[model samples]
Target: MANSLPVAVLFGVYLGIVTGIVPALVAWTLGFLFRYVVGVTIPGFGVLVLGISLAGVNGGLLALADPTIVATTDAPTIVTALLVVMMLTLYAHSRGDALGAALPRGAVAWRAIGERTLSVDLAEVFGSEVRIAVEGPVSDIEGFPPLSADTRTAIRETDWRLSADLPIDELQRRLADRIATEFDCAEVSVQIDDRGRASVAAAPELAGVSRRLDAGQRAVSVDALVPTGLVRGDRVTVRTPAETVDGTIVSARSGDPDEPSTAEPVPHSGAATTTGGEGRVTVGVSRADASRLLAVDRAAVIVRSRGRSREIELLSVLRRAGHRVRSVTLGADPPATVADLPGTVLAAETPDGWTITPAADHPLAPDQALFVVGSPETLARLGEVAR
Candidate 1:
């Protein structure tokens, strides 16, 4: 009976109650979020109110159009039908409504809206529906939770529940400027937790000065817009600070601290009221290299520090093939077996595996794969003779 006619009718009735609410709740939330979150003035509040009224009127008219009303024997049949529907709902719920088990769950999918009537599966969203929030002003959503970038990209529900990562506080600050352009709130608002579950809070708070400062540089870091595939061990030189890569991409980086650097040392003597904190820093040079790092943009300054030196980092640079006596390394090494110690160089080629030679330049890292390259005779000879 869950997917049967009775269940569908129940679903429709439930839809009626919520569909009756969709426009009003949406309009109010949208308009309210717009004024409060986006902080922009928009004309949709009137349209929302009107649309809600229209939807309610239309829903009521549709309800009245039911032919069963005319077929009823008693005068109270209309209300009686409604009450009976309610009683059946309670009965089904008591029986663990099988149809209700098939309803949608979790966050709303904003893109799905304007296509389907949201909340058709009432129990799916009745107490736990995904909220599609038209983000707006702090004042608009006085009690709603703030939005964040982390939350927005993860939204995946039919409700188009209004937000991804847009924390409540942020929605209020940024909502207004959006309406005039999109004629709709550009973003949505939702609250998410660490386990990836999303649910609604009563309100998003306004951002105060202290909050802004608290969220200051990290917020900028969070949305830094840095190029992808940026990893650790990368030969990074600042493009904005200067036009060159620090070590010119000798090795690609692949590790932690992926945020943009805000390493400018604070000044004690700059004017207290100064707005633009502009200064010059020159890095990695014996004066000549410093000039090389600096180009024309005075706005771009190289950051200097004590150990900001430039040199080839040769822990494990590259493998040499088709050309090798022993092994290449940071320092020269004496001839010895590859198993001798830390600086042993591995000789190339043979049936009997090649042994590493002890050398001064041998790289220190243990995980380095032995690179062998050279003429066949020389390779075979070393493979046979080097011990």
Candidate 2:
């Protein structure tokens, strides 16, 4: 009987291995395929446990199907063997369930963290208004190349936290040029703010606007006897140290806060101060003229070239055309006019949870969602404003 027991135990062990081979192969194949589909690296231990668990389940099934292979006359021993097989299968299956849920979620969380880190890094190195998203073949790679020592020094000198004398506009132009030249991308886009901050991206479906509103415009406050004749529609020639530009009178009014609207300019008064001592004229000139005009300690003289009304369009028609339309929340505060935006066109504004065609001059309030059409750049720029 002792010899018979040994022979039976040997046969059961053989049977378990024979049954487990097919299941182990199948389990490994499935795991390999699943890893590729999930796009995440699974640890070696997970694969091992999964293979063993699948093998255990197969062994248990085989024993149940043909009990004669594993069972002897000892009913208690046979039952104990079956239970052990069942326990192994259950434990392995549970572990597999955990891996299936955890692995994919971990991959997604890691990707989000990576994107956020890149956003902050790009913004800091480039400009605060500068935002970037990269994709395609090289997207998976992280970090940027080192800048020249001179470039680094220039950036550090312009840090807003420090007292520095670098010109903001020049820095913006230089950085934008550098990025455009250095980066090799299937596609690239850039956006600039009023303060010359840029947002750049690669492989972007939509292009960002590089146009600057103040690029060619300068503001000047004038106080003189000649200010009285200058009207908003009057064309004027402004000469500054940098360059001369033909500009239009944008606003002409008394500088005094309490003065009545009828304050008139004194022709040839040649006086520095008006009767109210508050009469001031504000003019819009080209940026070149502006730099020179602002630099000088002397007063700016304006001569009427002609009288005309010209419309300035800040929005881009080409960028807005053929763009994928999307809905975005307008946030608590939005800019005054839809026309004020450079890259996007506001199609509709939903307020109070109802949709309506938005008027260009309509007032924007909180809790409003906007439907806009433009490229990815447009969406990005609008997102900054909305936030």
Per-model C-alpha RMSD: 29.5, 17.9
Q: Which structure among the candidates has the greatest lDDT?
A: 2
Q: Tell me the TM-score of each prediction against the true structure.
A: 0.16, 0.26
List model 1 lDDT by residue over 1-387, tens digit each.
Answer: 124455445555554454444444444444444444334434543544454454556556655777542332232433333443344333323233222233222112232333223333431233322344423322224444544432232222213332223333323333333221222223333443322233432222244222322221111111112233332222334444444434211112212345564657333221111122332222222234335444444332222233633322232232223232334332232234344232224443333554444344432332233444444223333322222
State the displacement of the C-alpha of residue 200, model 2, in Å, after optimal TM-score superposition: 16
Model 1 Cα RMSD, Å?
Answer: 29.5
How many backbone clashes can be found in candidate 1?
A: 81
Off by over 4 Å in 2: 1-3, 10-87, 101-152, 156-211, 214-387
Off by over 4 Å in 1: 1-19, 41-49, 68-387
C-alpha lDDT (0 to 100) for residue 292 of candidate 2: 62
Q: CA lDDT of 74 in candidate 2?
A: 52
How many residue pairs clash in each candidate at the backbone level? 81, 7
